[model samples]
Target: MGAPELMRVSVFKRYLDELAPLDESDPHQLPPSLLQDLRRFKEHGRHTEPLEVLAASMRHLRNVAMHLQDGERVLPLTLFPRQCLAHCPLSLHELLQLPLDNLQVLHVEPAVLRPPGDPQRGLVKALHLYHPLPLLSWEFAMRGSREQLLPEIAGYAAYRASAVLDLRPLPIPTPLRNCVRRLQRETTSLRQLSEWPGLDRAVASRLLNALYLQAGLIVSRSHPAADTDGWF
Candidate 1:
């Protein structure tokens, strides 16, 4: 409603110039694929558009460019559907530039750290090398939507192994209240929490994503059973 954060006017204008043919006199023009990306950029940049859609458009544009150039897959990042970052310390622009691998390292449990020769390690190395531009754009898009996207930065697999979740005081939906109350009584891991009555793996993941967006969830890097006394 206000202004585009990730897709600024100046930046968009510059991109337009870059994609333009250097010599208009030359019959050659921008590639059809590149033009499609540019079209998406313009469509999403409109002030009336929803933030989530804009973010997705930005991500799409980036992926199109990346694939056309190198064929590398640019993974789509998820964000909490109800996140609010009005007072966040890190701006969307700044977060977009950070290394995704570093964020993953911070979130990943030590026990689950992939060995040097593992395929997971190769994937991480690839993400680091490619710069995670699409992921960052998705994050930027999430910042704009605030609630339309899921909140968690890392993928489900990243936290499946050693992640321990602790409940914090925050507004919760009526449907999840009882489940959350039980969690308050005892600490749980993603796997354990998902197994609870009425909560399947996908539901559990979405709830956690929502909690993360509200900044009302604590993710302990320690073993899930290390401090099983009570919610901290």
Candidate 2:
């Protein structure tokens, strides 16, 4: 006998429900207001799911969904997807090679971080930033300062223990390559990473920013038992 489709779909369904900003009596449906918020979240890049703030927000939405009365013909939020724990360097490397105009295309309908309850599926989510990557790269490469692009790294020392580094084999600069290899030994903090022998703290910060801008770096997964280190 075949497994029921719901069994195959339960995980995905659970994902959508968690991503919804509001709750519906149906559990599977989202309200128009929540849908509008998601659009704003996409434009502003506030759609990460691995942070407690977002989880809290979704919980709030679920509370709202629970009180809904009527239904609409609006599309399900599932049409716009997201990826979690992406292999960003290789992805960026390939993307950087594309033409500027092509890079301007918005590839992901919209992607966000995965919530806490999901299994540790390896690099399974489709990248939502693929479309905006090229443009972001250009902006980051040209006018972007490290501080402007990423301010969270300054406070990263506190939660480095929760950070996971899943690296892809790519030709990165020697110093950065060494840092990634060292992270594989154990979970590391920004403070600790700053003290590596012969590696400049600035270099480490640069590497982190580079990987992050490309969506290569994986932040700590949010868990009530464990600190999520606040999604950067």
Candidate 3:
């Protein structure tokens, strides 16, 4: 005997069904329409990108911050996969690193502030923005109104020499050994970084995308350095 058998998955499911009333008939599933994501993902019916959604959300949060009344405070919104609602959330360092190829991202906006004492606030399961980061590196998750390219950071391939990247305020990725010594001192465009570093275009592109969300590296679309040469 295997130390007393536990309930089967089917049996556990039955227990779950019994826990909820059949009359209610609520599927308890998030609506696909509620999904917020980049136009590219939605156009292709692809999975939502967590960092893209989060970085975008941070811009909206700034508006919420502006509306704060005297003594009112901005509450941290929790970001996580639809299925993995944890107790609390703040920073999205881990969320940014999620395997987002097939997962739906969801967030919780605080509703209790308006109602003052809504009991539902606690019932809701789903729940910032920049700093010096010497104490916290690799934490760009910036809150600002800016645009970026590269649909996915892990393997984004659309690198252009014209796109200027500023890593002065950010930590260097360990793979590129001298990134700290060179990139941190001044901003460099994609072309310069690749040629000087002797980095393959693809590797350099990945580096650019990884830093896209952080405020430190704003690819100035209007800047003379902006990439116009069809994707590298």
Which regions of candidate 3 fall more than 4 Å away from where they truly are? 1-37, 62-77, 80-148, 151-177, 184-187, 196-198, 221-224, 229-232
lDDT of 1 by residue, 1-232 (tens): 3322233334444655666445534434334443443344357552222232323323333212111000121222322111211111234444455443222100100022221244666433222223232333334333332322132232222222212433333334555767766655556666667678887755665555444433345556464443222110
Candidate 3 — which pairs collide? 108-127, 162-225
- Give the TM-score comparing model 1 with the true structure, all chains together: 0.30
Please give the lDDT score at residue 32 for candidate 1: 48
User: How well is each residue in 157-217 modelled by candidate 2, as lDDT tens digits?
Assistant: 3222213544443446576667666655445555455577755555555455555544455
Sequence-dependent TM-score of model 2: 0.31
What TM-score, to 2 decimals, does candidate 3 have?
A: 0.40
Least well predicted 10-residue stretch by lDDT in candidate 1: 104-113
lDDT of 3 by residue, 1-232 (tens): 1222223444544545665333323334222223233444557664434445554433333111111111122223233222211222323453344332323232223222211123756544333222122212133222221123344332212223222544554545555636534555545556556676556554555455545434334454454544443321
Model 2 scores worst on lDDT over the 10 consecutive residues at 65-74
Highest-scoring model, TM-score: 3
